[model samples]
Target: MISGIGNIYADEALWRARLHGTRPTETLRRAEVAAILDGAREVMTQALGEGGTSFDALYVNVNGESGYFDRALYVYGREGLPCARCGSPIRREEFMNRSSFSCPRCQPVPRRARP
Candidate 1:
């Protein structure tokens, strides 16, 4: 399940790869999976370079500093905002007790059930 991935990075990577979170792994081509992994790596590398994502005061660095990467995010926590790739608004869905964000135009809902 895509729930194994954290909500924040998952949304960002999905947007980068133009994939829907509910996409079944069995339905994905090897190249698509690779691209998604690459997207995740790229975003994570960028996040690490900028410290990390800190949503609140409780999540602070060793120096008690909040990360600045939140401002650089494209999809996560950007509900109702325009997508960078498509002009569609980013939509948030409740999943596994948390939220999942995606561009409805870019990442369409899957019609087939996951294997």
Candidate 2:
């Protein structure tokens, strides 16, 4: 969800992509993300300009039923499974009935040194 300057929504990309096709290209998706971030930044600027407190925050609802989380998981998931872009396998895992997918070639998971 996104909110700022009296504007709020559960899904910014879903809203922006309404004008275009629901299935947007990666470039278009990136643009939509940028627009949302920019809008929030603009809200902060507006607040600062008015001498009000300006701040930014991020929030996620794991239990949200609006499909936002599912959409994100679908896009970022499918790991080890063939990538739609490069034909790589999309990988996935199940935890408490929740699933996660990602492509190692596209999104390599960072390794942490063992203590």
Candidate 3:
């Protein structure tokens, strides 16, 4: 499940994979799932290299340095900004009490599963 991926990386991975976070896992093709996982791994690896994500003064590393990954983010915290891939504005929605960021044009809402 993609639940434990945290809001930041989840949004980043979804943007990188060009997949909507609302898409049901069971509805995804194996190749598509693989691509998403790969994208997540790639983004996490890059973030790790940059010392991870730091939102404010509360989040800091051992050396009390803030993470630089925030600067490299493409979607998270960029609501109303133009999407990197498409010119459409990035949108932020409330999900599970947290914010979910995505490009409406690039990552349209997945259709609901049939009953």
Best by TM-score: 3
Q: Rank candidates, lDDT, best first.
A: 3, 1, 2
lDDT of 1 by residue, 57-110 (tens): 223432344455446578887899998888899999986678888999999998
For candidate 1, give the lDDT. Answer: 0.76
What local lDDT does model 3 show for residue 82?
A: 93
**Tens digits of per-residue lDDT for model 2, 24-104:** 233345666666556445434543454333222312333344343344332333345455545667655452244444444
Q: Rank the candidates by TM-score, best first.
A: 3, 1, 2
Q: Model 2 segments beyond 4 Å from truth?
A: 1-81, 95-97, 113-115
The C-alpha lDDT values of all candidates are 0.76, 0.38, 0.78
Look at candidate 2 and tell me the lDDT of residue 107: 45
Give me the candidate number with maximum lDDT. Answer: 3
- Each candidate's TM vs. the true structure? 0.80, 0.30, 0.83
Give the least accurate 10-residue stretch of model 1, judged by summed lDDT. Answer: 55-64
